[model samples]
Target: MWFFSIAGVGVIGVLIGGVCLMAQRKSLFGVLLSMEVFTLGVYVVIFSMVWFLSGLNSICLVFLAFGVCEAALGLSVLVSLVRSTGSDYVGSLVLGHF
Candidate 1:
């Protein structure tokens, strides 16, 4: 009942993120945001399952910490890329620039 509804929302989130990632008109930051959304979807599914199966635990905290670190690292890369290229368009990026 409620579980199915919640899971459906999580799945929808994942699908939306996937669509965003596949979009052609996206900037580098947009791609990173999409990836973050995908990660968030995964977190939602895992957190819901764990919470339902037992009680909330330290594992949830670890997952959150990882998500934060991933976002930070990704943004750092994006910043460097923008600084070097003066643009955030993925298509314009060249391997030699790095």
Candidate 2:
């Protein structure tokens, strides 16, 4: 069924995102990228739901807008962190450094 196939794709996205999030913890950029992947996975899942329901399709756009906003905010934070410490490494942001 097309439904199952689409859902499977979404699940794969989620799995890859999770793996990337876990494996790419070295830098803030990596983490942010992984989070984007994870968000995209969720968006795929939501879009699949929209595919089945015609009336609720607008929700997908709302999610996309929010995702963009989140990404922009995340990039700003990463820039700030890197500017303050001169490095994007997670270890550079240890608690004692504050």
Cα deviation in Å at residue 5, candidate 2?
A: 1.3
Candidate 2, residue 89: lDDT = 91
Q: Write the per-residue lDDT of candidate 2 for residues 1-98, one digit (tens) a residue.
A: 78778877888999999999999867989989998998998899889878966568789999999999999999998998888889899886878663
- Clash numbers, per candidate: 0, 0
Candidate 2 TM-score versus the reference: 0.88
How does each model score on TM-score?
0.88, 0.88
Give the alpha-carbon lDDT of every model.
Answer: 0.85, 0.88
Q: Model 1, which residues run further than 4 Å from truth? A: 24-26
Model 2 lDDT, full chain set: 0.88
In candidate 2, list every pair of residues with a backbone clash. Answer: none
Q: Taking the tens digit of each residue's C-alpha lDDT, what string does model 1 give over 31-64?
A: 8999889888878877788877887678888998
RMSD of each: 1.6, 1.5
